[model samples]
Target: MTILLVEDDEVDVMNVKRAFKKNNISNPLVVASNGIEALEVLRSVSPDRPRPKIVLLDLNMPRMGGIEFLKEIRQDPELSSLSVFVMTTSNEDSDKIEAFNLNVAGYILKPLSMDRFISAVSTLNSYWTLCEFPG
Candidate 1:
């Protein structure tokens, strides 16, 4: 399954890539720096650009944040079923509540250490492998 990573931080983005490489995850990965860019990529008709089966979203970002993006996607018929996992540093209970309200598949706090990050991603890789997506 293809994975879309929506993050604005350069270091975090690189870390995700490293984690993917370390886990031997060969699924195609697409990156968008923010909600708007992510939406654009998701809506694009380019055949070469594969649609992601899952999205890894960050809660804090410019233009539009994760909650707002979740609201947008959950409201759209075309995108409503897209599985999303919130990956953020925000530990606020309200944020977690809001994300769950919008039907995110999972909510994961960003780990501070590279090893933990890899472990999280590795676990995620195992998760989607067991999932069956609608075509």
Candidate 2:
């Protein structure tokens, strides 16, 4: 499964990568620094490669933000059904509600500990790996 990680912070990105590595998730991972970059990656198509199966999004970003990004994706006919999960540091209830309203698959609080981070990644990987998809 291809995964797109949309985060602006370098440290957060590195931590996520470490978690994925610890969990042994071998899917080709893609990085997007912000909402605009994420949109470009999501809409891009390849003749021989499948689109990203999941998007791990961060709420705070420059140029564009996560809620706005979600709105854009929801408005697009082609990308409306794509799975997006919020993996952000923000614990705002308003943000969570808005994300759910916009059809986010899940909202995860960023874990502070390395072990918990790995566990979260493993759980996410397992959930997506077992989910049914169009053939």
Candidate 3:
């Protein structure tokens, strides 16, 4: 399954890439800078390129943040039920509550070390592989 990563930080994006490689996660990855761009990418999916089975979302962004994006998608019938995992630095209980309320699959705090990041990515890889997803 394809993976869509909606993050604004360039360094974090790069870290994800590196972690994926280290974990041997060869799935195709698509990147978006913010929630707005992420919505555009999701909407553009077609039969040839289905919507990503997983979305790694960041909560804080310049335009539409993760919470707003989740609300928009959950309201849209065509986009609802998307598997979204919030990967953010925000430790606020409110953010976590809101994200869970919006039906996020999981909420993960970004790891500080590269080793931890790689381990986290590996866990994700294992999770998706063990689970079934709609095509």
Q: Over the stretch 1-110, how does candidate 2's per-residue lDDT look in tens digits?
A: 78899999999999989988888889888999999998998888686666787899999999989999999999999888888999998899999999999999999997
Model 2 segments beyond 4 Å from truth?
none
What C-alpha root-mean-square deviation, in Å, does candidate 1 show against the real structure?
0.9
Ten consecutive residues with minimal summed lDDT in candidate 1?
A: 44-53
lDDT of each: 0.92, 0.90, 0.92
Candidates in descending TM-score order:
1, 3, 2
Better of 2 and 3 by lDDT: 3
Query: How close to the true structure is residue 66 of candidate 1, measured as C-alpha lDDT?
Result: 96
| Model 3 regions lying over 4 Å from their true place | none
Q: Estimated TM-score per prediction? A: 0.96, 0.95, 0.96
Candidate 1 lDDT over 1-135, as tens digits, reads 789999999999999999999999999889999999999988884667668879999999999999999999988888899999999999999999999999999998986688888999999999999988997
Clashing residue pair totals per candidate (backbone < 3 A): 0, 0, 0
For model 3, residues 18-81, the per-residue Cα lDDT tens digits are: 9999998999999999999999999998788878879999999988999999999999998897
